[model samples]
Target: MGEAIGQTIPLGVGVALSPLPVVAVVLMLGSRRGRSNGPAFLIGWLLGLVVVGSVALLVAGALGPTDEGEPAAWVSWVKLALGVLALLLAGRTWRDRPTGGHRPELPSWMRTVDGFTAGKALGLGAGLSGVNPKNLMLTLAAGAVIAQTGIPAGEQAVALGVFVLIGALGPGVPVVGYLALGERAERMLGELQTWMVRHNAAIMTVVVLVIGAKLIGDAVAGLAA
Candidate 1:
């Protein structure tokens, strides 16, 4: 459980650093209905993660009882595939990384964010967490790590819970700050948004590469044994 949790922390951090979701939450906070929309989005985000993690755990458990007190061989292969996917994503991220102080472009839908209500915001948040390409893959990878562990179901759930909370931190901080500090959060959130846009790709490249290599090594060891 400990090793599996350790493996997922980086993945959680990577998910947190995702700029699109953070930016969306920030923009929602800047709107008139922010009080409702922000929290709703956050709730949706957490729920989406919970659903994904739960599904992964159920599937892993249903595959059959294990005698080795560890994940079956197939889980390692899934991890290996995930690792290769991560490396490919990292390469793409590196190539597309912003340069010369330029920031990445925001999604077109972001232009209409202020017009969104709580329900739409909730759906958006859920989609970003469970459907967005980068976040979806990372969350699934985290789920895979948790599912592969030989820990009890309760412990697996706890590990996944921790991953979701940590993963949501990047998007949650701004909302919390805005609620706590009121007017003072704007400048901070803005600066954070800018910084995230500038550094997101670089951070993802390093994180994905390291996690990818680690997954490959773990898979090799598992298969060899």
Candidate 2:
């Protein structure tokens, strides 16, 4: 269990620091219906991570992810593939980064956040956490790492729970602050949102690249062993 948790920390951190989700949650907290939408969005984000991580664990388990205390051959291959995918995504993100003096704009859908119902916020949270390419890959890699440890199912659950908790931190911090500090959090969250928006591409590129390199290293080590 410790080993599994160790392996997943980096991946979980990658998910937790995802900029768009943090920005979205900050937007929700500043919205007209913030009181309702903020918490709903947080719940949805957590559920999304849980769902994706659970599915990956199930699939890895089915595939017999470990053999004789090492990752199974196919498991290593899957990690290699995921690592390569992450690198490709990092390249794309880096290429798309705002250049020169051009300002980065939030997506069109985000403009409507001020009027979103709680359900819509919830769904958006889920989509960003579970369906976004970078986040999905990181969560899947964490799941595979947990499964590859060959821990008992219960231990695997614990490790995954830890991963989910860590992954929730990015959006969770703002929601918690809002609940505790009310309007006092507005200024801080707004500042955070602006910075995140400005550097979203750079942050994603670096995080994805680091995780990609780590996954590839792990894969290579597993293959060599």
Candidate 3:
């Protein structure tokens, strides 16, 4: 258990950093949602999470049962520990996040997303978040974590659903936070947008560095075990 727990530190780290494109899209939404549009950015982000999470659950259910082979007890513990570690890494990012900076901008394609349908926000978020390989990676990672834990099939599906929900949160939480802090984001975006072009490289380097460390750490931890 202790060994497995130790290994998850890296797994969680990887999960924490895997949603760049989605995150970028959420960022581009920025203060534009509520202040600029009608609702808060959180509304859209939360919508996206709900959509992605639902699809992910369906995918997990379809995955249908944990693998037959049993892993060492240590692996399970590592997965459990990885969950905790992922949370910790998230905290580290929260603490280290720039004192004042808007969410990062994304490619022009993301701007076209419109959450006005009957499915509205969730559909938009899902379409963007769904087809991404990151979702597949996390779903697979959830299987690893569950299989290692020796959970039964039904339970494994449930566990995968939950982990994927948390994974979706990588994008969900930030937009919510930014939306709640819309005024702050607006101010920060204002200031940063002015000089962001010059600092974009450095800022991105830091974001990538942090996320890369998380992913690489998890990969190594899984392999090491």
Candidate 4:
């Protein structure tokens, strides 16, 4: 379990630091129905992470992710593939970064956040956390890492729970603050949102590149072993 946690911490951080979701949550918090929508979105985000991570763990377990206390070849292969995909995503993000003082464009759905029902917020949260390419890949990789450790099922659940908790911190922190600090949080969160939006592409590029390199390194080490 310790080994699995160590292996997955970076991947979990990758998911937790995702800028867009944080921005979305901030937007929701500032909306008319913020009191309902904020927590609803958070719940959906947590559910999405749990579902995706559980599925990856189950699939990897079925594939016999470990052999003789070492990762099976397939685990390394999957890591390699995921690493390559991350690099490609990094390149794309870099290409799309705003330049020459132009403002970055957020997703069109973000504009509709002000009018969203709790249900719509929930669905949007799920889609962003589970379906976004970068987050999905990181969560999948974290689950695969946990599975490759050959821990008992209970330990795997604990490790995944830890991952989810960490991942939730991205949006969770703001929501908690909004609930606790009420309007006091608005200014701080607004500043944070602006900074995140302006630097989103650069942040993603660096983060995805680092994780991609790490995954590839782990894969190579496993393969070499």
Predicted structure with the largest TM-score when compared to the true one: 4
Candidate 1 segments exceeding 4 Å error: 1-4
Clashes of 2: 0
Cα-based RMSD of candidate 1: 1.9
Identify the superior model by TM-score, candidate 3 or candidate 4.
4
lDDT of each: 0.81, 0.90, 0.45, 0.93
TM values, all candidates: 0.90, 0.97, 0.46, 0.98
- lDDT score, candidate 4, position 60: 85
Question: lDDT by residue for model 4 over 86-201, one digit each (tens)?
Answer: 99999999997989999999999899999999999999889888999998999999988898888899999999999999889999999999999999999999999999999999
Show pairs that collide, candidate 1: none
lDDT, candidate 2, 1-225, per-residue tens: 999999888888999989988998899888889999999999999999999999999998777754467678877787899999999999999998989978898889888899999999899889889999888988988888888778899999999999999999999999999999999999999999989999999999999999999989988988898
> Cα miss at 216, model 2 (Å)?
0.8
Measured with C-alpha atoms, the lDDT of residue 30 in candidate 3 is: 52
Best by lDDT: 4
| lDDT of model 4, residue 108 | 96
Single out the weakest 10-residue window by summed lDDT for candidate 3: 31-40
Q: Between 1 and 2, whose lDDT is larger?
A: 2
Clashing pairs in 2: none
Error of 3 at 204 (Å): 9.9
Residue 64, candidate 1: Cα error in Å is 3.9
Off by over 4 Å in 4: none
| Candidate 2, poorest ten consecutive residues by summed lDDT | 62-71
- List of clashing residue pairs for candidate 3: 4-77, 4-78, 5-77, 5-78, 8-82, 10-218
